[model samples]
Target chain A: MTPAPGDPAPAPGLIPRDSLLPNLEFPFRDLNSRVTPTECFYVRNHFPTPALTAGGWSLTVGGAVLHPLRLGLEELRSLPSRTVTATMECAGNGRTFLSPRPRGVPWELGAVGTARWTGVPLSAVLERAGLPEVVAAWEVVLEGADRGVMTEPVPSPGEISYARSVPLAKALDDVLLAHEMNGEALTPDHGFPVRAVVPGWYGMASVKWLTAVRVVPGPFLGYFQTVDYAYWEEKDGLPPQLRPIGPLQLKAAIARPAPREVVPCGVTYEVTGAAWSGEADVARVEVSVDGGCTWADAEFLDPPMPHVWRRWRFRWQTPEGPGSRTLLARATDTRGRTQPTCHDPARGSYMITHPLPIEVDVRESSP
Target chain B: MTPAPGDPAPAPGLIPRDSLLPNLEFPFRDLNSRVTPTECFYVRNHFPTPALTAGGWSLTVGGAVLHPLRLGLEELRSLPSRTVTATMECAGNGRTFLSPRPRGVPWELGAVGTARWTGVPLSAVLERAGLPEVVAAWEVVLEGADRGVMTEPVPSPGEISYARSVPLAKALDDVLLAHEMNGEALTPDHGFPVRAVVPGWYGMASVKWLTAVRVVPGPFLGYFQTVDYAYWEEKDGLPPQLRPIGPLQLKAAIARPAPREVVPCGVTYEVTGAAWSGEADVARVEVSVDGGCTWADAEFLDPPMPHVWRRWRFRWQTPEGPGSRTLLARATDTRGRTQPTCHDPARGSYMITHPLPIEVDVRESSP
Candidate 1:
């Protein structure tokens, strides 16, 4: 069905994991390029898309600031802008693989995509707002225009705006108030008008439908910040403390020879996939055919880039005999972090960066 | 000070993590051969080294068997023997890295060593004991001759033998009762006369100073099995369940260019380490120089083998600038399991297989 005006027109093959909140997953099997097309990029929304226009929208910056500033879309564009090629991944991208199934959107392996974001750095807006009170500021909370009553994790008091907070240091670093995705205006599903694009962090930190930025002196205890998108920080002899999830864990996902795909025996097949991390560039990607018993490095299609996924491919000579084989890919980030084989329960359903197994069948001939 | 008669004469340079229990660590920096020499192998003893001779020692196999047998060392040696080159690592090998420091042996990265073990397979002994009762058998308990009063985790009523249980499937697979290590008689510190060698499992399961083997119809609840060597098995929405630690997790350790050691800048330096896993072969090893920011595959010196560690080396051209740099290595197992970067608290003090960071100073010249 064709989407209505202002509605998200997902790419033809984009798989909708949920319909109401519009959580779409990109078809990774079709992944062949580094930058994902706008329509083909996965869409993750905490609430129904808000019908908003650039002419009426203005980002309000206040709280812990000497000067409160309201900058309209035109004013934001007039300011010096920067474009960053980054990969944004939903925190719960691989939630479907969590045992006992976590209580959240069940994403598989496609809730991640890369794009070129153009916008004024949040630091510029914060600077214009004046930060004489910054000495006491601990975090800058970004509030989205989209609002909804939270159900799971905990019931919120009436309808609340979708919001999250980032540490003051991160806000002034590479955070962007992006109005353009790729080389064009942001689409409705992709946070139209303007959105906060937080590089090297989970997508939740980059709140969509940007509205207000509040710099607070203390930690933000919002529902999304505490009840959801948080992990248990376990210490010896101490109770597991809850901490908000942040950076993306190093991860790799196999794209080609899709799960259970039957391929002809005794032929070389090009296995392709993407590897990414939150804080570090993916240094190496390895492919394993015998269920991880042995691994060979996959050639990177693109040079190492900050805040973006690297495409990698490995050529696998299909076994002479027809049988079932499990294909797996694992990535190690420059910071020496490697994808784990087992899901960490401390992370609950988020940061599913474990090496996922893809079982494929080798047949005498393609079935 | 020289050790007296029947005392453990450790090899020169073996560092003692604990003096009383004689938990010695092999100097990994001196690791240069595939088979670690007898005196150089790390020694782990719970109680005083037992002084026993082969003529006086016997292995008693009982419980849930049609034929309970007591085979002396001579009889055991008369049976068909197999020599396996395997790596035995203490479960708490890297406990020193755990934050807040869990109670146990404070080991660094030296509680592991490889050796050629010559022994009679435990499966052969179990078969001679007759397995008609195997239908109800659940686990095989291996008890050591050494006994000590337990104080940590929980207090024991009196001195008790060090005993641990292995699943029936694993006990019947590759478990060995070895009387020889590196083609020589087992040393007093290395479980004199005889010992159980549970390949592919943590060294704890091997039960040094072996005395008895008991097959039980249910899980064994020995002090070591349940209290000391257990981890919390975390499942969603459930209280963390306590489960005994089992097979070794995939791990790699940087053995050369020792931590904090200074090397001359602007020259080729060989980064060497060893990687191993419990159930699969070490498939790949990658070395990271920039605190894990980027990685290059290390060349494996040894061919892939079952139940053994693979030594790997990567030649790195030292940067011209003199500064402190962190070196790290990560390994992936054949089963697609890669070493985790962070320690999981759920594992407590056991399975410390995360990539350990080795900070080395690149100086103008060697001091």
Candidate 2:
């Protein structure tokens, strides 16, 4: 039963961000485990789960290829497989924190998760299908099975499938036509039959329930590509510029002893969290217990692993003062990339990897 | 050029721990990068490098299999491949820190590194070869091409190859017959043609230049498995009990502002370092700048990637007075496993992931 207005509806263990479309987040504290359990993996869908089965599912590779081919599950699995552990974050992961909050899913810091994905490389499939002649003016279009209708910014409304396009070089780099996740078959909520795993890009580029792969010459102005994912902004009294969102920016968040938690004063508690980036490896992570006054570097639990998020932890000794305290964390990558302290208001609803602060109230120690 | 008695022979970038047999360590500070570059990766060779080529390499999967099979490089590459990022440490990684150093390589902390390995899962190969009937007594033996003469505990000296055996369950678990490392083909020093990547285990379990996979019944007493890698000791008038070394223990080390470093007082500096474990994910890492009087949790650069090492850093505010100081770090894993403050003298030199203390001298500020 729905409670009050603006209250998220219950969906098992999910922290629902919106009542509609089932956009939800796994409680960040449950991230203690290495790989996010399939049941706890975050779910973000544009439409209802598609009705499909592995028996009837097939991926079509066409357009600009010397030999077009359609591969079933068995055929795709026959190719040499590769596995990678990677983290994926929704483009609007921290949308709720924006000033004058954005008009989308009000996500907190739980919209990201990491997993081990196994599949055949897109390049291997392209090479097996006989690659087209090398050309600079080529783009790869990916279309998922989920389709719906949109009303906003439309003159003539029509049905459209969830689709996006990437440059030829990126599609051929490390993208995977994935079939398994975390050593098991994909679940229905996470694109049951097949999906695209684009290594360093935002979640939108990884279309789920994938069905078609098109190697098109020149750009294709699809709805998701041209209208939705691009950020339009008017700067300095000039004409508006539209820039499409791409890689995920560096960011960190405190997960344990979640936001606004209360604890006993003088007790030592552990402050644990996660940090991630799109393409670059994290070079360093610094944490601050007294807001941002004094920062201390936290110890990473694991060695640096490419393309995957890293877990970090800090121990905080609460002073005897019975008052509110704040904790903050920030990340930097090897490519000299860092999270911005403040975001540009013009760039809304995407790539928000800001260093979020968590508040905790310290009470007098119990007798 | 041989410089001195203990100087390791020049082998490009390897930091020699021993002069004769190429026992080396990757410079610990060089671990700032995510994946250790091949040139700087630590090397541990028991004998001269073997002369083997991929063209002549054929892995024989025989013994207890229902249908034994021999696979060439092309055939192995044709199978489904999987990739994982994992940390591997020599059993004697911190041997130098042990009091009364054992009669082996006096290695420092540089004997550990993490990398992305790509290969076929050992389970898949076993299934393809037709797994034998279920039996609790089954074991898997892996033999490498490198061989040398043995001189200890023998009536007659004989030649023996590098070999080890593991329980069937572990052999079938996430083990990979790795052929590539860090997105490229493996190098000569790092087992060029192929090797075993036994995730979460010590480096000895991952034999380099792997040549044979035998499914043997009961236990196989290979030299590396029974004699060298096991820890044998007597306790309280009891018979000498032997336990085989398996997973890596939780541990951490300060990488920067190294031991005996001199820094100006009254200046705030950042302390950087790394921590890792065998099978378990690290739960927390605490740093003590003032000898263990007070402990502060260090910040991790990233979330814990399963089976990989983690980088960490901390900010230190040097006291005004100039004197001697000590820095120490200890790690704990999710399984409630923590590094011991002091080791039992009887344990000797293997599996020492203990909390290491670093000495530093704070100097007065320059006039």
Candidate 3:
């Protein structure tokens, strides 16, 4: 269906993967700042931006709680607020590179961006609703105002709200009910009024267009929870089990010397890129210029942060002869988890953290 | 382009993945014998079957050889011949199951079959061409009469002949230039006159429509050799390298109780399937009836063979309730290599040897 006139439009300079549901990708080649500009941030929408007004909208917290609470935008803003600089990435980023390409948005290494999010701590609101000791083993289900019919992987029953669940511990730890992005009010495309900012997790966990929160006694088996963002877990002496995908894998993507870009030979070129991990701080980044034959360490441009991406740069002395070359970058996390050189099919199309080939041609002389 | 009036037509009951290219998949569900019927064998074609007469066609052997020889079909058949009962499967046999569906023929699970291949051993022909001791470190490239433009992970420069290479050791071992299949002269769709049958490799390595064989001093980097049918190889502290795919991994496929088939509950059902491995003989076959929660050993109907598939069956006692169910099978080879519970993305769309889920439904009563 064509987007309605009131639907949010993607900002210029963003690569559009889909138009109706509006999945925009950040052009990584334009990565020039630590905090992606509001207009430059990638937008991943499961449905058209819901027409929500802050004055009329309310977030309802209920289910398995002693005291159910409903709070409007004004009340939420009045509560204690915190700001976090984090990088959010779609689980399906860099999906196009998968051979025998799996079905999806066909993202190409750009569905990620870093931004400063300002919001009220979810624990404060949950405390107002009175979380009992019994809820420690339960889960907090977050529901979004956005609803749509999912068609890929499997068909859903009618239109379903975008909902996911997090461990009660995680929800009460660092989760945020975000209302401001990069010091500005949240735009409609950015989940106006309020959204969830799930640090250290994939972007999908940060449900956009927040509407409701519920405490459940068991695992949430919603479409997005069990089916879409899930991977097979194989254990010794047991059958492989399907588990929900959680943290991001270590990854580094080259943004400069763009794919197939022509550069002059015999010159020292500065290769720049970004590295991020969901589990720990990025400890090191390496660049391989001659098709993985040799590797050199890159300098990190950003300080080590828990959930923020670190910008990195490397200098390379080009070959004297003109020829084609492939550049690859790999990131290693503080936990010793390094980016895999090959895609893991068990992750399906999600967690595409493999070191990808970025091809470039070196010319004898600059044109 | 539409096939000419005389173009080879797929046999009845064969699943056609591409009508124009004549890529016919075997109906594996009808596998009721040790040897697949000639008409039921799977046919994977890269280009339209070239019209050739046995009297006019000849096989050429040259390149890095002390003596070069060209022989006609009758002369080739005059040499010592051997018969091999082997199972050949397309590397992308189960590609459709890959999430974020990969681009290709979209084959489900039937692009495989077993047949008795009859012809002269490639070693006999190479011996006539006089392979010198220095050729031990070289490769033997096989060229086919079939030619076409390839547009996939990357496009080819122009129309190129279907070609591949094997190590000199392998070419002189069990490779075959076969002119007959299942006790009958090969049909046009099956590469009439001659084709190379590499016993344990994926179907692509068994180049069809044999035309020329060349011994190269080093690695062969043809489009098919390096660009396609290749996977990323990862080693400790080394950059990932692209390597040509060789032998198949262990795989087990359920053929009976077809996917989503309905069966009566509280009844004894015999689940049947086939298992094969390229590296070693299948050591064991296991079936999981409860969504991988438990597994039971299956009874192998065929004896262990080096390059042949073994059929197996499991007796399942259906639950006494009506509901949906999933069936899974896994195979382990003598070399301790077992079918992985998940797809290894490193193999790309090829080597899809994962233990696949076969879903079915259970009814209160037989309908």
Q: Which one wins on DockQ? A: 3
For model 1, the local distance difference test gives 0.81
Worst lDDT 10-window in candidate 2 chain B = B1-10
Taking the tens digit of each residue's C-alpha lDDT, what string does model 1 give over A286-363?
Answer: 999999999999999889999899998888888989899999999988878787789876676788888888888888
RMSD in angstroms, candidate 3? Answer: 18.9
Q: Which residue segments of model 1 deviate by more than 4 Å?
A: A1-11, A133-137, B1-367
Regions of model 2 farther than 4 Å from truth: A1-367, B1-12, B152-157, B233-240, B365-367
Interface RMS for model 3? 19.3
C-alpha lDDT of all candidate models, in order: 0.81, 0.75, 0.82
Q: Which lDDT tens digits does candidate 2 get at residues A252-345?
A: 8777767777767886777777888877888888988888899888888767787778888777777778998888899888988778887654
Give per-residue lDDT, candidate 3, residue A62. Answer: 85
Name the TM-score of candidate 3: 0.51
As a whole number from 0 to 100, the lDDT of residue A170 in candidate 3 is: 92
Tell how far residue B306 is off in model 2, in angstroms.
Answer: 1.1
Interface RMSD of each: 17.7, 34.7, 19.3
Candidate number that wins on TM-score, 2 or 3? 3
Error of 3 at B215 (Å): 0.7
